[model samples]
Target: MKVGLLFDARNPDGWRRPWARHYARILELCEESDLRGADGVWFTEHHLFADGYLPQPLTLAAAAAARTRRVRVGTAILQPALRLPAQLAEEAALVDLISGGRLELGLGAGYRLPEYALFGADLNRRFRQTEANIREVRRLWSDGGITPGPIQDPVPLWGGFYGPRGARLAGQLGIGLLHISRPMFEHYRQGLAEGGHAPQTARVGDLLPIILADDPEAAWPRVAPYLAHQMNSYRQAAVEGTDVPPPPLIRSDELRNRDPDGPWGMLDILTPEDAAKRIIEITQGLPVTQLIFWASVAGMPDDLVVRNIELVSEALPPLLQAAHPAHPAHGREREAGPPLAAEGGGRG
Candidate 1:
């Protein structure tokens, strides 16, 4: 029942020149707002998307670790197959030390043909490569003697999956699972049980787009366009043979049997209340340990973003408490300490 925030670092306006300052402000706000209220902060990695800016999560997370003392830091997902596993292990350990052992590593095989093409990585072998990368990274962290071992013994490694194969792999590897939605959660649970790893206590977190408003109706116009844009982007990725499937939230009949064109043809009509209700219902059915909300998608105004966080904070507590009455509060004794120095250097 822990709550966290996820940001994609998207640049919907196609502007990159101001990315440094924009991201700095983003980190600052997250430190001041999200870190104080939530248990963790998460980011994602994407490339060449005129709509998004971040291509590196380790660097960004290292900054976050330095700025915040209490909140855990993580990557909602980094494409493990595209980079050297050893390098990732080193970076993850450094970030963990900087955060005083509050790093949640979520690794993924990666989708997006454009990213694969840009990196010259074979998309088809991504799953195998991800598995290999996870094995190597774990080895490096647990046994390989990198100077200054991780602050926490066996830093938690969460497998990011959008499908059954990756979910099964996570259970088999004895790592936590990161699910994107409710259906994904159900799929992962079945996958884990089938993998002969039933009753595993490994961590699981859900990623959902969340926005809260005084009146759900008044909030729709402000958030819907951005939601549509993201949906369309995923649809494009799916059409290009990336493993991402069309979002199940959108009904099949609405697309009129035609391929889901970006969000324009499919997403504009859905209301925020409907979206929130859908997500709530989905999470309730699944065995989710934590729920992470992507509150700031492209084109979502900063004011609305803050309001959404407030709404979610007020609304979700009851559900979370009911599901996990023993969930820990944010300002625990372990989390109270002076800010630590940024490991590997750079402003947090």
Candidate 2:
């Protein structure tokens, strides 16, 4: 029941700050999360997003690594198709070393057509590219001529998935899986077993949007705009053939007494008590290794996001773990394959 915080720094037009300041604030928030009982801090990548999404996650990851001491630093999903495998490997290794072996590499085949076009990459080949990139990156770290590879013997690698294809690919590669829902989590585990690997050989983490407050009714006004913006943005992308599916529309009339089990990808808005109760219920029959709370989203104000993080951190983990103990992901420490054992020295 490790709890991490994800920063989806979407600076929409009306709720925007200067680009430089916006990033600085995100990093500051990451630092705060580290001090306030978070196990990890993660960043996400996107390109050509209308709301000025953070396109360069690795750079921000390095900055976060430098600023934080205890919390692990990670990329929720770094699009492998956008960069050369060797380059991506180098950057990831450096960040791992810089963070004192605290980096979890999360890779993805990006969905947006515009991003692929802008990067001169073929969207149709992205799935293949993602698989290729992971192989090449591992090879470079293990056998390439680079001096000093990652500090972690084989850095923990996780794949982000939009569907079963990605889940199956993750299983085939023997990497961890990042899924948005419980059904996807099951798919990933089944895929792993189908690949002839033990289900416990890989881990699964869930990325969820959560809003925690003493009075959720009073808090909805402040959170709805950001939540709505996030949902609508994904809806638009889905319409354009992005792999992301549109979430059920978030409506004001549907705010109160919302069923926790109603939809697969809707936001979770609850008081601390309800959050603990709902989370316990959600993980009752699930083996979710990590619960990565998406506290900062679509230009929500810093204070509110920080408060939400605190509330979630305080409320969820112990309760859920108490309800469902002995998650296998917490016990597994096997690396997918042996490192190439390259000869290089780097500070980690």
Candidate 2 wrong stretches, greater than 4 Å: 180-186, 194-196, 240-262, 325-348
The CA-based lDDT of model 2 is what?
0.76
Summarize candidate 2's per-residue lDDT along 1-348 as a digit string, tens digits. Answer: 677888868889867777887787778777767766667888898877789777888898999999998778989989998999878988998999999999999999988888888889999999999999899998888885465689997899999986988988888888888874566776777778777888768677768656776777776777777777777777676556455665667664454455667664557677767776766766665555677878676877655676677765555555665565665222323222221121122101
RMSD of each: 7.0, 8.9
lDDT of each: 0.67, 0.76
Candidate 1 regions off by >4 Å? 14-17, 180-198, 238-280, 313-315, 322-348
